[model samples]
Target: MSADPAAPRLSASGAHFSVWAPEASHVWLCLFDADDRETRMPMTRGEGGVWHSEATGVGAGARYGYRADGPYDPAAGLWFDPDKLLLDPYATAIDRAFIYDSALAAPRGEGGDTAPMIPKGVVEAPLAPLSGALPCFRPGGLIYELHVRGFTMLHPDVPEAQRGTIAALAHPAVIAHLQRLHVSAIELMPINAWIDERHLGPLGLTNYWGYNPVNWFALDPRLAPGGIAELRETVAALHAAGIGVMLDMVYNHDGESDAEGPTLSLRGLNARDYFRHAANGQLINDTGTGNAIACNQPMVRRLILDSLRYFVTQARVDGFRFDLAPALGRMADGFDRRSPLLEEMRADPILADRVMIAEPWDIGPGGYQLGHFGDNWLEWNDRYRDDMRRFWRGDSGMLGAMATRLAGSSDIFSGAMTRTVNFLAAHDGFTLADVTSYEQRHNHANGEENRDGHGENLSWNNGVEGPSDDPAVQAARRRDHIALLATLFCSRGTIMLTAGDEFGRTQQGNNNAYAQDNAIGWVDWAGRDTALEAEAFALAALRAGNADLRGAAILRDADVAWLDESGAPLSVAQWEDPQRRRFALHYRGSGLAICVNGDGEACKFLLEGQAVNVAARSVRVIPPAR
Candidate 1:
């Protein structure tokens, strides 16, 4: 386990606040009143670079900030300004949302005091023990990825007051929708409090994705009306419904950008220790968010682990999906799978049983650590996404790759037990409907022209781009969409479906809709799209009813036979053939034969010694002659 830096302990009498600022000459605790007035008191410096202070009047519900008097040197990566108020790195709750201003990020000479404008931290009362038994999340369970606001913001059945709040999602109508798909877990995308990026002001956009975080521990007020209590109630409700919750967490970077970025919390408290920097003190742009968090540091590791365990014990969350997890495992040497933070999470007494998922890649050097997260950790397989896309889009020479992903990507994740969290669409990319209905990403609304999203989406338009009135093209898009989702569910390991992808949700070809908070990003519940919804339920039912598909252990070669159209396992020469796209997969134990045609035209397959013709860009599921 990493060294415990358990400072800022709270008690009934008052709060014990301790900060690690070795360079500071003096430090003061600034307690704020309801009227926005601050009562400043000097803090004494302790051993090991920690400054400690305890105030009898300051307790839970008190709003406070910090003032550290240290050298104003940016060249050495120290930017301590007494006039600028800083947030506690261990703060449990924040008073309000972060409102970014240009003056907050400027150098001391160029900028003035931001305390008046910056949000203050609020000390929260300790949480009560959870009421009811929680659902246990494990491999092979279905995950429904959603955004709290967008998931219920426009939900017709949800009350207007509850719209866009955590409680809104726990409504019976919303839970029924989740229950319809048998979602064993819900992966909420970043409910943590975050500040809008400075660049978005001019474009009149907001950080709808909640990736740019200012407070790691506070829940976004917009998403949680009653704050942490509201979230706990929601989780308890979901647990009662037999569904677990997994939070999508961002520890890779802070809302603070490069040198010109805001001081916010950690950056203002201790920039050098909180974030990664080169030998010359320049910030490392690993997360592409300006500054990458130095998770290798003991203090930062404590922050992450402490926050995780807090959610488990206080909020009763089942697991977490770490965003750009490579940043957490990075070191001065390079990316290490056995880094202290990773080891701590794996061995932590509280976190060991929790479901740990990794995004698996970052923008740093050797950042792509897919299939390298050791054991007991599942990964979002980009290989599954790409191969499934290429094969279904009628791209030739991909049959072998497609076969590998369907069988749990043994070529990549070959540790015996399946750790692949396979999905055709997630929150970050194009929807399953859009992937087959559009060729190019139309991200004009992002205000970055059309250069914002991924260039190569490996998508197909099915003879028409974006929304098409052509019935033939629409039918083809629907066919491809259902097939892609079916493929995802039929694959080994766990399967995740985006909230509206099952019902043919479209972002109008906008792959990266992170900034758009309007109707463009919200799920379309008005249009029921019953056909695609049924396909989703069919896939869920297929996984639940078929033991072979959701095998506890990795399916052995004898369990499945990847056969050619002639109803026989493909020969070495046939498997290598680029023109080979039509194949029948037979689950030997389950007596299920599925014929997948990836060709541009329909193909005939001999199933159970009986000839059957399958359409192009489609999948045919049949009982093996009963």
Candidate 2:
């Protein structure tokens, strides 16, 4: 579906590269030797804004880069300094570790050659067609999101050498954990090659969240010790185990921060055309990052589609979750659900059946298109997150909103056509444990003076802040933890749980642990709660075995009944009661009644002829006639 693709096409004799750089009068394909010696060969220019070249004896594992000589004007957004060894936009593998160097920061002046300072792309062979069929990780299935590094960094069962690597995620222990939760897919946080923000090194922090992407196709060396092969192997293992792999992609923008950021890939080649700049040539900031990509451009769109197809055909990933996804739907006038990019992806034969999840918002004007995505695209439901948090926190008049959320958030995602990926916490926010342990975000460790993360987290401390030693506070937090997980599993539509949240994991109340790549961010397997783990398994089993809960259609009046403490359907007066934190939802024919009592004291609910007592701040899933 791409206009021009397969940039580096491998041939029988050698590898051929076709780059799009119309403005450049000349472009050099630079290859490096084992001693890091450079070999420069000029590429011939052709019509349609393409540059082509082929080199013999250069197939797989060959290190290469490109230098385009055109114009250099920051104000005009030219950014064409040939001194920088720009990474190939279509690079599939990269060599060496990425250390944040100040020299790589801004184009302050015509910087010297950066070949010795930065990593270069590796020439890799094309992937063969998979022997088996793709995994059927349907859109509405339960998804477990996790970070490769954080999930395995502190996992004692994984070998030390494989820890934090793509290979580590395939360990038997990790597989068992996902199986226990009955997760259909694992939406891995961005494992693509990324850069640590220039401000992090000076602040003694690291870019642990992986949002600041540098190379679109290559895997980050730190996270992929064995590169693309390891990723493919890991995904195959997951597929064999009946679990799907979904990648969190960041195509909305690049790591080239601002005019003052790194000249890594797109920025160095042709900033004026590759990036969206104002009339005065100022970079657009739609992504909240320094520069928003001009994806409407044919070449940029080609790059995105090519990278996507590569992963599907090569790595065998089941799907993708686009971060800050609104940027993908932006046209000249505004965001369009039928934008060329969105239409192209949907029409593509390879991507149509695969799962596509959109974050569905950006920092640009008219950007929050929550429920505005086209058909077949599932979206992250922030409304569900807020309502669930508020209701469980004992907020007044939250019962009505909670009812809507419980029914797959039909108020927003009305279509039984597309499902919602409902989650209480993700990588960018407080972990489930932190949600009940801290009222406010404690991100002082992020070097931003506790001012980095979301201010209004809708979280409660139970009775004390941070870690609690008091038995009462500890007991209450543990109960609320189970209650939140229960609500997620019981809610209609697909649910997502962050890794390590099953047995209680905390980031010390730091909602924005994007820069805290230490023990605070890693999962502590040694300290997991065994009892809570069993409870999580039971909850998963409950959701999996219920046909009504996993139905493909939106539930309406006859399908659901909102009952009061008397076991009868609630009246208008009772629905409006300020103290109606206690309620029950009897899913028709599911034979399960999910009762919640958010009060500070125990409450009794009439279940059929018997009055069953449920403890306060707890959620109980009862079977009919039990």
Q: TM-scores for all candidates? A: 0.96, 0.97
Please list the C-alpha lDDT of all candidates, in the order they appear: 0.84, 0.84
Write one digit per residue (lDDT tens) for candidate 2, span 1-626.
Answer: 12243456777898887677778778899999999999999988876667788888787888999988888778888877777788888888899756677677546454577888879888887677553465558655789999999999988889998999889989999898888888899999999999888889999888998999988889999999788889999998888789999999998888888877888878877788788888877998998779998877877887888788878888888899999998898887889888888898999987777889999889987799998886788889888899899998889999888887877777787655437878999998999989989999988998888888799999999879999789998888889999999888887777888998889998999999999889989988899877788888999988888766655466687877888888999999988887788888887775578888888789888877678788888888887554
TM-score of 1: 0.96
- In model 2, state the lDDT of residue 452: 82
Q: Model 2 segments beyond 4 Å from truth?
A: 1-7, 106-109, 131-134, 624-626
> Which parts of model 1 are misplaced by more than 4 Å?
1-12, 129-135, 611-613, 624-626
Residue 390's C-alpha lDDT in candidate 1? Answer: 90
